[model samples]
Target: MKTGKLVIGIFSIVLSVIIGFQSMIAGLGNTLSENGEAGGSGGFILGILMLVAGIVSIVQRSHRGNAPVIMFVIGGLLGLILAGSYSDLYIWSTVSLVFGAIILIFNIRNKKIAQQ
Candidate 1:
């Protein structure tokens, strides 16, 4: 697997673990309320979505396809945007930018390898 993909996969796994643990500890409703200022079934659904996305991203890293990588990048970007818009925190946005840059670098490396 590419180094960038591996890093992103590991990060996603870690993020999933953190979010899952938080959900378990605080309950989805409370957690969402704390972070997003909203609560209820939607929060639970969002938590589930995050979990699924994290797992899928990790799994997709090992597969030989650009589509998954692209999706991962897009999802990460979206997450960052949402975080910034909703929470007014720029951390996720910065992280997302770095992650995207790393992925892009690895993609270029892969293309060069293929050409050679």
Candidate 2:
């Protein structure tokens, strides 16, 4: 579980970096035409949320109990952001959501195991 959380945290930070860069450069000629500001601040927030949730899940996997729930919320927000995209951000948003869900489920299972 610790390893899983570490991997997830790193993955989430990658997501944050990617989205942050995309947002910073989104005002370019054609990038904003599709992605625009949709994935700018919103995606950035979700990415940060995922990052935090991932770290929390990892750092407190045994001590804290609600880590997976945090991830579930992040995944839901990512899914929502993906829904209103211009097809260009579908891949990024969907990928983030997938990672968030994976983290969520992994933590949930880990929590259960810890209970036993």
Candidate 3:
């Protein structure tokens, strides 16, 4: 398995879990207000999208397909946009970017290997 894909997949999955648990934690702590509910929902949705994209990227990389590498970049750009949109959640965005960049680098490396 490509280390790049595995790392991204794990990070995204972990982030997704964290985003999901944040809501649960807030609810358990009785800290969620009406406004907070909607506010957090965005993270939750984005987390899931990232999670799915990450998984697909990994699967594609394992198959040696180039299409999934593009997905990584798109996911990363989206994460960057999301990070800028919400200062409090830039960590996820950063992780997404790293994941995408790593995958892209690995893809380039693999292509070079194939050419050589």
Candidate 4:
């Protein structure tokens, strides 16, 4: 069970990194619209947040914390708010949100088992 959680955590971290890079690359091309200036900036920030979340998730030995949850959630929200005209940004952000939820669920389950 612990190994499973670690695997998921690692997967989530890798996914976040992939999504972050994707968002940033797309962000570069997103600088041609009316809101272009704000587009890349938000994606960049979102990417950074996602990366931070990934880092946090990997650093924590116990999967029962809320730091990863919060960071990923914030990253997801930022992606949604910042994804004005970029369609890809929406997908990336949504994925980040899902990963956050996955982490949350895992954490909760871990806590429950610990209690037992």
Error of 1 at 37 (Å): 5.1
Candidate closer to the true structure by lDDT (higher is better), 1 or 3: 3
Cα-based RMSD of the predictions, in order? 5.0, 3.6, 4.1, 2.5
Per-residue lDDT of model 4, residues 1-116, tens digit only? 45544565576667656666766666676654444545566666767777677677766647577787787788789878987776777877887788788778888888889899
State candidate 3's TM-score. Answer: 0.65
Q: Which stretches of candidate 2 lie over 4 Å from their true place?
A: 27-37, 68-72, 75-79, 82-88
Which candidate tops TM-score? Answer: 4
Backbone collision tally, model 2 = 0
Worst 10 residues of 4 by lDDT: 31-40
Over 1-116, each residue of candidate 3 has an lDDT whose tens digit, in order, gives 47767776777777778866663454443333433333244455556667786677766765556554555455545545544234444566566556666767777778888899
Work out the TM-score per prediction. Answer: 0.52, 0.65, 0.65, 0.77
Error of 4 at 4 (Å): 4.7
Clashes of each: 0, 0, 0, 0
lDDT of 3 at 66: 51
Error of 2 at 38 (Å): 2.9
lDDT, candidate 1, 15-100, per-residue tens: 54554454344445455566653222222333344445445545656444554345445544554444422332234334444555
Off by over 4 Å in 3: 23-39, 64-86
